[model samples]
Target: MSTSFSNLSELVTAVKAATDAILTTEPKEVKRIRTGGLPVGTNNQYFTTWDFVNGMIRDHSTCTWYSLLNTFEDERFSLDQCCALVHRFDYTFSNFLRYSGFQEMAVLAAALTKHLPTAKTREEAVKAVRTFLAYLNRLAAWLFHYFPWNIGKHLTYSYTTASIPTPADPDLSRRVHVADGRKVRLTWQPLGICVVATLATKENPELCEDVLRELPFSIIQDHAVVSGESMYAWAPVVSTAPVHVKERQCDAPVGRIRYSQATGNKIIVQYGRVTEDIETPILGEILLQYRDRLGEVGSAVWKSTFETKQIILLTIETVD
Candidate 1:
């Protein structure tokens, strides 16, 4: 476990594995830990670093990740570095540069491979894993901000009021912290939808639909509790990009946002209003998206406004 990773390829592999392991877990192993089956520690509460990592990799539950709350606190330096880089570069970074939609992940991975040197010690290796994980998360948030039309997190269902979007469903039990701190308890209820997009002509539209299958749509809800208070913000509105005509005689449209469908009504704009119980509180929006299956919510670049302040401009989609 102390071996140094020699090349950037190995580092990339580690980074990919770390990300792929985000929502994965093993319940049997976690049970073993909790029941004191492991020789190392009494239970998860007394878990060592290895035990903690195993629990996360195995069961990977919110409870397990909650255990990492202390890990992040203890490694505040690395956490801060990760946050600063995202805030300074990823979030506030210039839109002057961008990779094509499909190449986003590749470009993100490429950046780390630059300043990242091969690890010589276990500490260095641990730092690299944390830093790269942070980088992946930060990039994920930025993608939501930069590409609202093409990307948004999955929403289990649209909620117009303070009430939870989905009822007390156990399946919607997964939760994770978003990138932007706002220092709140941010939870994204990930949900997905599917739409069919094809370039076939009207005569062959059905054929094209059959050929390509329905495209995947992910819409994450910005519903969460911040600092022990129920906070809410309106879901972002996404509209079809303006279709412009190159020539006056040509009636075709141009400059419209791409993607034909969306989840909620654009005019209504009532996804995240506070519940009837409260009047005022700090809230966040700007949910995250992942390439995961529809029922699973992906990561995102969520936002929160402080005490009646304004919020960011973003949008989520619904199927046509």
Candidate 2:
């Protein structure tokens, strides 16, 4: 019972538990972050465990300086490595990408998500580390040329679906059987719809338009012409917890824009760019370069069947 956490999963659980403590302790201060008009953590979309951790690392102010050190000791996640993960959210530091895992074989490049010991051998662990880093650097370069915004800022994913509410009133629609009737809703904060909308307003709006017109209709479900441009590939980020409100995309911090060790940037790029090509649906190529320890999961669950969804990995070779 006294054994320390031996894997990434346990460590992640501890980190989340610590952050949840903060939320439980200070509920109003978090609600105040909405700034009266900024549509975040509102409606059914509440502040997530990742959001608190992300806020702590964004700047020294909210760094949870007291508990963080203890958490570091407990989890054995180095302050440098922790900061490096935060840097991955830095648009200039790590190219925030979106891709269906199986299509890109991202499962092989799980170093970013899984712990190092998950690898079979030291050599494999080392390669996974190298490939993980190479992917970050090269991916940043690719997104810089392809999209207009910084990568997902301190992006933490939301649960696949929100909790289902109970039916006390027992009246919804009469067109269906009472026993079979239930509510249907989708949350998009993690889906990156706002990611696409924000990018549409970038410098070379023409490229986005070109990509839009030629989009394979088979890829999207429900889309719209946003900001007078032809934007596809996603539904807008909306909240459905208590009420419905249009939500804006979250922003990443610019603290460590470029890679630097002297600034205390601790991302150790161990491997060089081993892959030669980048593709939209941007899979297969990048993941092939890494060691397969814990791999990216691409089951039917993660695939987008909608009319428009945020395409995570956009490259010059992206479907045009």
Candidate 3:
């Protein structure tokens, strides 16, 4: 029989417990298997033992212990197996080296409840899992970097979209590109986990959009940049400026309106002039973008535009 999870929290707890048990047991078993190092009680024992353990973990075979199931079922797993499952979830930060050999915990969470009634539907449950995993990836990176390991290895936690060879100059810390011929110079502070990126682009800031959209982080602050520059590609720092909520009165012309992120979770009633070439499904696009926070469209009304009556007003009300 399969176990059911009432909620994501419950499912996460169970998965974490199982993974922890396996990690604890497998290391001890491996240690016992390789028993003849440095006469058992020497100062070099700690380093030698850790080296062996980490090496075994890295060289683990993918066909057996490191293999991952397509969907998680109620079963025990080895360290590499658990890691394989978690690695799938770490899609956002996949570029980072697997120094510790763990992947996305969120993907693992999604797999664990893939066939369960944890949410109303499998798609909904998966969305929730990915959101939780995004948060978990950030938290885990921070925690792992600071974790007090008895071993001598220091895990690498930072991620970048691209990499360049080590700079010969003391001033050149790292160089990343926002677009062709546009370079962003980065400098790391002493013992700093935080990364500072400064993009040198031309008059057109759209060049930075591609780079911004690929960042693993959710939020960032930009200087002298206008709102909606990237269509919420990355969350911006909160501004103190007054925000105006625009609604199209039935009598008002539909062609004058534009979309706003200021609406928060409210279902959008879009009244605008769309070119014949644009056949985009607005509601569907909105739902896909905010699937975790917003539910389905509660109500939609299509009416002829007040101005020219050529286009239509799409009123999309979403469930909270």
lDDT of 3 at 213: 39
187-244: candidate 2 lDDT, tens digit per residue: 1223322111112213223323333333321112111111111112211110011111
Q: Candidates sorted by lDDT, descending order?
A: 1, 3, 2
Looking at candidate 1, the ten consecutive residues that score lowest on lDDT are: 248-257
Local error of candidate 3 at 231, Å? 29
State each model's C-alpha RMSD to the native: 19.3, 23.0, 21.9
Error of 2 at 32 (Å): 40
For candidate 1, the per-residue lDDT at 117 reads 36
TM-score of each: 0.24, 0.19, 0.23
Residue clash pairs of candidate 3: 86-104, 87-103, 90-104
Q: What is the TM-score (0 to 1) of candidate 2?
A: 0.19
In angstroms, give how far residue 14 of model 1 lies from its true place: 2.3
Highest lDDT: give the candidate number.
1
Candidate 2 accuracy as lDDT: 0.24
**Each model's backbone clash number:** 30, 18, 3
Worst 10 residues of 3 by lDDT: 221-230
lDDT of 1 by residue, 29-105 (tens): 33343345545534544345233433222222122221232233345546444433432333212121122121233
